[model samples]
Target: MDSISSRIQEVTPSLTLAVTNQAKAMLARGEEVYGLAGGEPEVDTPDHIKAAAMLAIQEGKTKYTAAGGIPELRSALSEKFAADNNLEYAANQICVTAGAKMACFNAILAVVEEGDEVIIPTPYWVSYPEMVRIAGGKPVLVETKESNGWKMTAEQFEDAMTPATKMVILNSPGNPTGAIYTEQELRDIGEVALSEDIVILSDEIYEKLVYGENKHVSIASLSKDLYDLTITVNGFSKAYSMTGWRLGYTAAPKPLAEAIEKIQNHSVSNATSFCQYGAVAALKGNQGFISDLRDEYDVKRQFVLSRLKAINNIRVVEPKGAFYFFVYTGQLGLKSMNLTDKLLSRYKVAAVPGIAFGYDEGIRLSYCTTLDVLNEGLTRFEQFCREH
Candidate 1:
């Protein structure tokens, strides 16, 4: 008899993927799907980035270059960290991985040990705790209040600490909720992490998608000490609409960076070669497409927010970044899975169950599709809520 490893067995398959795949299957069967469950931008990759990748292929730059990343791309990332986030990292201090998801997993695997605790706030991106578990670390989830905009307070961070606490994961302009941590709030959390000597894994993949007066702040940039304690993870997937490109990176203190690179060396080796060239182009080329996409998302976000507000029996805090809304469906008197199942099966709308994000009272809806789909999906969703 064969058996799966306990670590792998303990992990739950990503429900976000499950929902998206189901929606895709329905669409494949010629059923109309609103397709509000995906986490990717529904746009073509910018032409210049594609041209750069094609150029790399033409130049035969397709062979494996480095486990961490190609030097040129890493150097480009070094400048990106400085110019965009106000954090300084030499090329050697960065490790490029297959995607931001892998960058996160590599950082966790490098540091977390058995019995160590990793604090994760509630309504987090569904992957964080699972990554910690795979690394043999206990994920200590601290429930955050909805009234506080679903953000964990610094006091809450300190309260969650134990002698066994080894790390804390922070996602800003976060997934599911789209909550952006303010600069002062980051300072307060940094102070707590500093006092406890906890490693910070800051996921800022949604950094470039913020709206209005809200700005994305890298927690590592708050202070030198915080920078030393942080492994900042970011990627091109969200910002550049390059999800299929499979590129992202981690910038850490020297030792931590070395360990993450070692893990990368043993695992998926390197991100795709020509894609690295594309990422370089994504970094160095024209940035207007990002703003244009953001402007479109902002319009969809407002339309969804207004529609959700008009619906009875649900509540939603406005998301200032990223492209999702974690709408509270508690008053509809169904758990997220049930609500989402009914929405998909009966109303032809697909959404991620918020239970996947550790919040059973809500469901996450992505506004990454066209306004026409948004209008139709929200109309059906409103009908579903009313009947329930």
Candidate 2:
């Protein structure tokens, strides 16, 4: 009999990726499937960013870089964090990784220890809990309700903490929920983390895509105490539409940054050198393209939410940020997996089931594609409800 490590056995496969892969295979087989299952932007990487990468390759900057990051990219990220989020980060306080996923995993490895508790609010991205489990920390989940717009309450978070709690991951403009945390709400949690000496891992990768006048507040700005305890996790992926480049960086206390660097040194070693150059260009070049993408996303968000809300059994909150609309489909009485399967087989409108994100009552739809595709997908969804 073959034996795998207990750690490997304990971690489960990513459900969202599994469903997405299945849909991709069908699409490859000539099915006209609308792919709302992918967590990436459908838009191509803008020309200027691509041009920068080409220039980087021409200049021969494509070799190994420092395990942490290139100096220029680190400085740009630090400045970007300070200007955009009002959080100051020195060069030494930054660590660039392959993606925000690696940045997050490295952060967890740096801070979490065996038997430590990492509080993860549900309706979370598929990776958070699995990453914690891999790090030898128990994932203590706090269920964030749909009625509250999925922003967790102070009480819910407080009830989940113990002396062994080392960190709490807060993904605002969250992945599946798209619920933006009000400033006061973030402050409430920030204060608690400060009190408990729990580190706040603020995943603000979607900070730039918010709709309306709802601002994305950085918890580190709440107080100096909270600032010291908070690690601001952000990337070039969502904001600048650079997901494929695999460039992400985290700004934490200098010591924590060092520890993450050590892990990187032993692991993947650095983010791609040319990609780091492209990331620097992304931060410094035209900011207007981001606004252009956000405007389109806002239109899609409204269109999809209004359409879903009109359906009898579906409940969709107009998402305040990001590209997703997390709609409750619980009345279908179909386990989310079955609902998704039926949608794929019969309707060909593929969306991610909420069960993948640790919730079973709903599904996530990405409106990141063309308006025509979104409208067609919504039409299929509307019909699916009626027929079912």
Candidate 3:
């Protein structure tokens, strides 16, 4: 190959995937490794959803359908946004795609252009900045601190916005940090975004994975102006344990939804046909599965927090949502990548380095594994810290 496109060059490999794969390779070699890197839920796809997919297959619903999504699933999603999030959206304003990741990608491509600045918060999901880079938009990262719960402030949001600012990416029940913005926090930031006329790509993929007294609030539900300026991206993966089903959708204003649909149409050409039915089943049939899962996750979250607390010289804010603990390891006197590599190669524990999420001297530990695995990993991590 002579040379790859610069756009492709601008993108970086996902650190979460890299750590997960490295752990898998270690296990393949018959080594004992505790993989605490990935964010995917360990639960199987719910039976009702799987049954719906099977029924669709039996009924010959495997053929190509609408480029955006099946009408039934879109309608179900519209009802879901309204009933659950208090956001009114019609099927015509929804664009379903392969994953919430793709939904975000489509929305970014639809709205962002060259030289446009997209404001993102620090300790963000690894993909947000890379997606902006690939879209030819400059990613303006606003650093939020652990002291402030890793949540962006209205002042920071305003300070980052320039005349060139075109969009802002918001991830709640956020990855790595597990921080969820409160209704007031979102309203404050939403005001700045509204005043600047910046569109918001609100990634709510982890909305249902929240814990404690914490609640997930959609900025779009705060006001009509916020709703018009926000692209709410959600999916069946986190809530329904349908990661492999690859079905996610965005609810936006009609014109933006159409743009997302057009991008989805020319690129992936809709999600898998039968999987859409499974998603429909997920939205319509689910009532109790998520609650039970949340209870279990809450227990696991506490266990992880306790383990991290016992380890000396590690600083971690208690996570209120999602399933991660962003543990600061600056006292260990190692770069984040080196610390992560040592954890995997020497300690037989796998974790993603904080540098991957735009934070230094830290690592992200996901507690979405079995109790036995979590115990072993935390034990090894504590021992490694003591040795250092």
TM-score, per-candidate, Cα-based: 0.99, 0.98, 0.98
Model 3 per-residue lDDT tens digits across residues 1-388? 4498788887999988999998998899999999899888898998999999999999999988888899999899989998889999999899889999999999999999998999999998999999999999999999999899999999999998899999999999899899999999999999999897899999999888888789999999999999999999999888888888888889999999999989988998879999999988888985699988888999999999988998888999999988899998999999999999999999999999999999987999999889999999999999999999
For model 1, residues 52-137, the per-residue Cα lDDT tens digits are 99999999999987999999999999999999999999999999899999999999999999989999999999999999999999
Per-model C-alpha lDDT, please?
Answer: 0.94, 0.88, 0.92
List, in order, the clash count of every candidate structure. Answer: 0, 0, 0
Q: Residue pairs in steric clash, candidate 2?
A: none
Q: RMSD, each candidate, Å?
A: 0.8, 1.1, 0.9
Can you rank all candidates by lDDT, best first?
1, 3, 2
The parts of candidate 1 lying over 4 Å away from their true place are: none
Give the lDDT of residue 236 in candidate 1. 96
Q: Is candidate 1 or candidate 2 better by TM-score?
A: 1
